[model samples]
Target: MESSSDTFGKDDSADAKLQESRVVTEEEWLQKWETNNIGFHNEQGHPLLKKYMDIFLDGRSGLKIFFPLCGKTIEMKWLADMGHQVVGVEISESALKDFFTEQKLSFSEEPIPGIPGKLLKSTTGNISLYCCSIFDFTSTITGKFDAIWDRGSLVAVNPCDRERLVTIAEIYALLMLRATLRPPFYVPDSEVKRLFGKSCDITCLEKVDGLAERPKKWGLDYFWEVLYMLVLK
Candidate 1:
């Protein structure tokens, strides 16, 4: 199988090809941490998430969950405490290394075929970090997750890739049988219906307070915003 990383050459635009070519080789992506340039990384949990997590999750346990663009999120550990297995896909090895170090656990790594990915294993569950791109793993990963968590994935990426992101989210909803929330960006209901059809049900739509824009550091204009939660028929 061809590795997913091999599918898209480095430097491909995030909005290119809609599905096949958005993967880009971004050395600067990791700079957010190396230079401490992260404006979107929230130190505290999302307030809206805290208020409604139970309403959607209902104390569910052992559900497989996916967190795309997950960057050492403390929420993953929180989910683990509730007995859910969390799977995160991240591109930056430095961030991943820092996360595990902070967690104080040793992780085992292995390659995945037809994709440029290294599977990281912890006692809680296995996390597959794709070196290639998100789209490549879409077809490889099976058995839909109970929930998909997005803290900054959507908002962090350039807006032109919105359609592709929706396609991925739709596929995830079909496989997992549930959709939790994709935050920091607002995906329109019309677009959701257009992609998944009008039969799809929206579970929740709420806005949470964001802390990235305090005294306006890092040239950020942070504003807390609404996010989408949808379920497909």
Candidate 2:
């Protein structure tokens, strides 16, 4: 059931996104952190992440939540603070450091015995951030999760990598994913159905007229923040 504009939910232009075929490299992301060129970086995180917190919890406790391409997101800290374990993967190691340091969470880093990357564990042991590419990550590495919080990961991801992204969030890994679609990475509702419908049941939770509110941000004529709940079928 879809609701209107009060719904909680773009820097890349439609044409630019459409024309760009090369997948964004991990080095580029590292550079974004190094240069502080991350315009999309938000210390506060997505507002809907907090508003929809209950939905993510879904009457559960001690949920192991996953975040793909998590770049120092505040949501992880918030969940960890709430006593849920957070498993996140990102390519930039510095971003992981920033997350722990900025959040004032004490953490220890160690190399994965059989892998090329390292893992940072919060001293309290509720949060684990993987300093590696999302593509190399699996349930085997992070273990299973109860939920997935996908805010910017989908849109920031190249079209080619989407299949892998969706596969990683399969039912075997999590109970559900709250796919919050945002502008600059405008993926329409129809496309969403085509992508997730085969494996998961799709539901539209809310739709907000985001373009009307921030008409100048996306450089586009129209934009809507739509939320989709994808549950394993």
Best candidate according to lDDT = 2
lDDT scores in order: 0.56, 0.73
lDDT of 2 by residue, 1-233 (tens): 65212232233344435734757766777898999877666667777666777776888888888888888989888888888989888888888999999999899989865667999999999999888877777666767777888776777777777788777778435455555445435565555666677887776776666554345564667556666677777
Taking the candidates one at a time, how many backbone clashes does each contain? 3, 2
In terms of lDDT, the poorest run of 10 residues in model 2 is 3-12
Misplaced by over 4 Å in model 2 are 3-22, 180-184, 211-223
Q: How close is every model to the real structure, measured as TM-score?
A: 0.72, 0.85
Q: After aligning candidate 2 to the native by TM-score, how far in Å is the CA of 147 from where it should be?
A: 0.7
Model 1 Cα displacement at 25 (Å)?
7.0
The collision pairs in model 2 are 10-183, 10-184
Per-residue accuracy of model 1 over 1-233 as CA lDDT, tens digit each: 11111122233223223433344335667776678665556557555566667654756667777777777766666766677777777777766766778767677777866577676767445444344456566745555667777665654554466568667776665322222222323333333344445545554355444434452553434443544555566
Return the top candidate by TM-score. 2
